[model samples]
Target: MRGYVAMTAQEVAEFMASGLFDVSDVYAPTSQFIVDHQDLDDEEIEYTLSMVAAEDALEMKTATSGAACVLAFEVPAESISESHDMSISLSSPLKWESLECLFEVSSDGEELTWYATQEIDANLASWLK
Candidate 1:
């Protein structure tokens, strides 16, 4: 995976939200996909549901091999003392040519770790020889 462009979770988030990342032909969901296959944790579900509610633009990362990118956001505090944050990680297989095959993971700020949630669209899956 060397020489593949790498970005931090914050960088990925900014790329998605700020439109710096090109999203042409990419799937930017207005809501989390309700698939029966994968089940997300509470924190992961919360992040996905938030995306459903917000209009922020989203983007996918490019991968060379086993590559991953992360998108993070700060959840509005329920109270002044509460600060909840979440991050979603997107992964792709070796030499992926497009956003297809991307999968998702979520992280709560407390542990700074990710939990698997969903598999992204595989529109380009057939493009492979």
Candidate 2:
């Protein structure tokens, strides 16, 4: 389709400068994700998972730092009642440029609020009934 035109080299550079990425998939249930495209602190990793677990959201396994060790955590619940998009910081910086594929998932783990309006006529409905 016309929507899928390939980008030229200059176009790629421009896109990068325009903040065209959101790397949030590193904390998904179906994928083995690594945190922080850059180096980070151990506490940051813990904070990421704790946010997920506190929400009762699922992940593949434990979160770890530079080492290949498995990690576990308890979920966080404090921020939900308030509408905030959750995020985690990485323990150590990682320097990977491109990813092959990202895993995805959608669950009813948390409820979001929405509101809308509709029109009706009570008198007309009552007469029809």
Best model per lDDT: 1
The CA-based lDDT of model 1 is what? 0.28
Candidate 2 per-residue lDDT over residues 12-47, each given as its tens digit? 233335524322222322112332222435455444
Error of 1 at 101 (Å): 23
lDDT of 1 by residue, 16-102 (tens): 345444321221221233242147654555445434322222233223212233323221222112111222222322222221222
Q: State every prediction's TM-score relative to the real structure.
A: 0.20, 0.19
Candidate 1 ranges with C-alpha deviation above 4 Å: 1-19, 25-32, 35-42, 46-68, 73-129
Clashing pairs in 2: 38-93, 39-93, 40-91, 40-92, 40-93, 41-91, 53-75, 54-75, 54-76
Candidate 2 ranges with C-alpha deviation above 4 Å: 1-32, 35-39, 57-129
Clashes of 1: 0
For candidate 1, the TM-score is 0.20
